[model samples]
Target: MKNCIIIGVAGGSGSGKTTVAKNLVKAFKSEDAVLVAQDAYYKELKEMSVQERAGVNFDHPNSIEFELLKKDLETLLKNQIIERPIYDFKTHSRKEETITIHPSKIIIVEGILLFAVPEIRDIFDVKIFVDTDADEMLLRRIERDIHERGRTFESVRDQYLKTVKPMYLEFCEPSKRYADIIIPRGGENKIAVNMVIAKLKRYLQKGAL
Candidate 1:
């Protein structure tokens, strides 16, 4: 069998990086493709109080369990299955159990800060950055966090205004230079998506699927 291909999709919060990654996974049509999200690696927060959790700057790179994540991905790349951590957004904690992931023909790792760390960045065959307007992203983040993450609108706005927005500018946006493709306007740009799909198809057929 051909070796699996690892693709990294990264962008600012609510910038549609996951949307694009999902579409790419579906386009592959092979059951051998797996989707892994960076959100799943949020540091275990069991002992921290609500006040302590609220004080966390989640947008920071240190907020993720990078060591564990890197080890898990390495196992997956070696054709071995691994238990992936499951993070609870509402509770701000890690679940007792993890989800199992089997070896796949393709791996799509999506995150807001995928390229921020050099260790994780080196493993990807393809790196994508979803570029979207700040105003639009903030609006989408507010709606998603309030509705899906069980967060108050005021808190969501506060977090975005304070940590999220600043981190995107200082950490996420600057990492765009490392991407193989810079997708403007995120998933709304079909041209960029189609191009990525085409390139991936070619790679898949070239004994690297």
Candidate 2:
């Protein structure tokens, strides 16, 4: 972790930020890099009823446990392993166990509200914003939530209208100004991704010098 580079990938839900982060990881050897998803840091809702948890505004910055997320990243930066939380999207709570993440030279943090929270955002060495059309975002969200996240179409659509779109306007969208790089055309923009990969390699190379 001696010259570790922390990259923040931020965007609206389903904006392809996770895809871009995965692309960055693909550019490096596994031992040299790791991906930390902000989705895993959602505040534990053990106290809430299932119905109440379902009503929670997941798109808001307050829904995430940013202090713990920052601390975990700081732990990794110190060349230590961390017991990363494992969240269950279906259950809307964290699992009893955690996964261990070893230190890496490159850390890619991907999430919708990543840049909106100052405590977490301030720690990033590079801030990347993935830009996509709102309509496309909604489409992708609907697809992913229903298939991958075990959410119903009605639930996904309702959440988007209730929290996702509004929260993006109030928090996530405005955060684009803090980005050092804005990647257009979503994650399929290989040229933009490659440019970033090249710069990241240079950063690691320079650290060796």
- Output the number of the lDDT-best candidate: 2
Q: lDDT tens string, model 1, 17-45?
A: 98999999888775768899999999987
Q: TM-score for each prediction?
A: 0.95, 0.97
Instruction: Tell me the tens digit of each residue's lDDT in model 2 across 1-209.
Output: 24798999999888999999999999999998999999999999999988899999988888999999999999999999999999999888999999999999999999988888888889998999999999999999999999998999999988989889999999999999999999986789999999999998987888831
The 10-residue segment with the lowest total lDDT in model 2 = 200-209
lDDT accuracy of residue 204 in candidate 2: 84
Backbone collisions counted per model: 1, 0
RMSD of each: 1.5, 1.5
lDDT of each: 0.90, 0.92
Poorly placed runs, candidate 1 (over 4 Å):
none
